[model samples]
Target: MVTVKMLKPYYIKADNDFIRVILAYQYFSVLIDEQVYQFVPTEAKEIRINRRTQKVENMGVRFAFQKGKDIAYLTMSELISLPDFLLQLDTIAQPYYFQEKTNQKNETAIIIRELEQLNLRRLIDKSLDERDADTFHSLTKML
Candidate 1:
C-alpha cells in the first residue's frame, strides 16, 4: 500500500565517506496514536542530533540544523519530491538510531569485480584514457 504519497523529502546526512546518507529528523511505523522517533547517524559529529521547526515549501521541507555548535536549516530535495517521506517527517518524534542498509562496500566490491571480469573496467579505462589524455599529457608537458 506504500505509494508516492508516503515519499517525501526527509533530511539525511552523508556517511563518513559520503557514500550513503541517513534520513534526517523523521520517523516511521509507530504504534501509539502520537508516537514518534528521531534517528541519529552513528557517525555524525558536528550535528549528531538536531532540533528545529522546519519550514515547508513547494519544493520540499526546510528546517534548522542544530548540534552542539553547528546551527543551520538544511533542505533535502529528492525525497521531498516524493510524498510518503514527507508524511513521516511531519509525524515522528524522539531520537532513534537510523537503521541503514548494511554491507555496502562488500557488496559493491563484488559487483565491481564481476564487471572487471567482463572487461567493462578496461573499456572504461580506454574511454578515460582517450578523452582525458590531452589533459594528462598537458600536465606531463608542463612537468
Candidate 2:
C-alpha cells in the first residue's frame, strides 16, 4: 500500500502574480491565477542558476505534469526564496526518498517523509507592488 502526505499550502507573490502552492508526497501543485498546475517533483529540470545575482533566472526551472500536457516555469531575479522550495520538493520526489516495510501479515507498505511548511513570503522582494505586498503579507500572516 502507498500513502501520500502533504504540507500546508501557502501563497506567494512572484512577478506580479499570486500563486498558491501545495506541497505533497512525490508531487507539488500550484494554483496560478485560477489555473491549477500539478507536477511531479522528480521531473523538475532545465535548471539555470545566476551566481552574480544569487538567484534563479530566465526560466531557471521547468516542471511538467499530466503526461507532459502541463508545464510551469519559474524564474527568480533577486527573489531568493524559490531555490529552497524547489530543492526540498526535488529531494522528496527522488526514488530513494521512500522507504518500504513488511508487516507481520506480510503486507508491504511505503512511507513518505513529511515536508515542512514553506514561508511563502520569503519569495517576495521590494520590487513587488505595494498593494500586492500588502495582500501577500496579510495572507501569509493568516496562514
Candidate 3:
C-alpha cells in the first residue's frame, strides 16, 4: 500500500499503480484518471501492488521506499528535459522540505475557528424572510 501516493508516474504509464492508504481511516484505494483501481498488494516482504483496471492493463508495481522518507515528484515532460547525467538519479534522496510549514496552514486555522463556534446567530440573521414570518406570527398569537 502506498503511504502517500502520486498520480504523475501512473499517468505517465498505463501500468498498475498503487495510490494511497489511510491507516487511521481503515481504508486504502488506488485511482487512475480519477477511477478507483482494484489492486492487490503483493506479499514478497516488500511493498508491492498489482493493479486491475479495464481502461488499462493489469501491470503496474511500485516497491516500497524507506519509511518516513519522501520522494520528489517529476512530471513526464520534466523527465524528458533532464540530461543524460540525471538519468542515474538513484543517488539523490528526496527530503521532506515541507515538514516545517505549508501554505494552507493559516487559512485552515481560520476556517476551523469559525466552524468551532457554537453560535448560529449569523445563520439566523441571513434568513430575513424566516425571521419576519416568526415575528408576525408571535405578535398576532395570544400566547
Top model number, lDDT: 1
Worst 10 residues of 2 by lDDT: 108-117
Per-model C-alpha lDDT, please?
0.39, 0.37, 0.29
TM-score of 1: 0.21
Candidate 2, which segments miss by more than 4 Å at Cα? 1-26, 41-59, 65-68, 76-143
Cα RMSD (Å) per model?
A: 16.4, 19.6, 17.5
Evaluate model 3: give its lDDT: 0.29
lDDT of 2 by residue, 57-92 (tens): 444444543324665553332122444555543443
Q: What is the lDDT of residue 15 in candidate 1?
A: 38
Order the candidate numbers by lDDT, best to worst: 1, 2, 3
* Candidate 1: tens digits of C-alpha lDDT, residues 3-119: 222212244543333212234444222111232223333323121222222323223444333334544333346435446655555444222323232245468889988876556
lDDT of 1 at 68: 42
Poorly placed runs, candidate 1 (over 4 Å)? 1-59, 65-74, 78-100, 120-143
| Candidate closest to the true structure, highest TM-score | 2
Query: How do all the candidates rank in terms of TM-score, highest first?
Result: 2, 1, 3
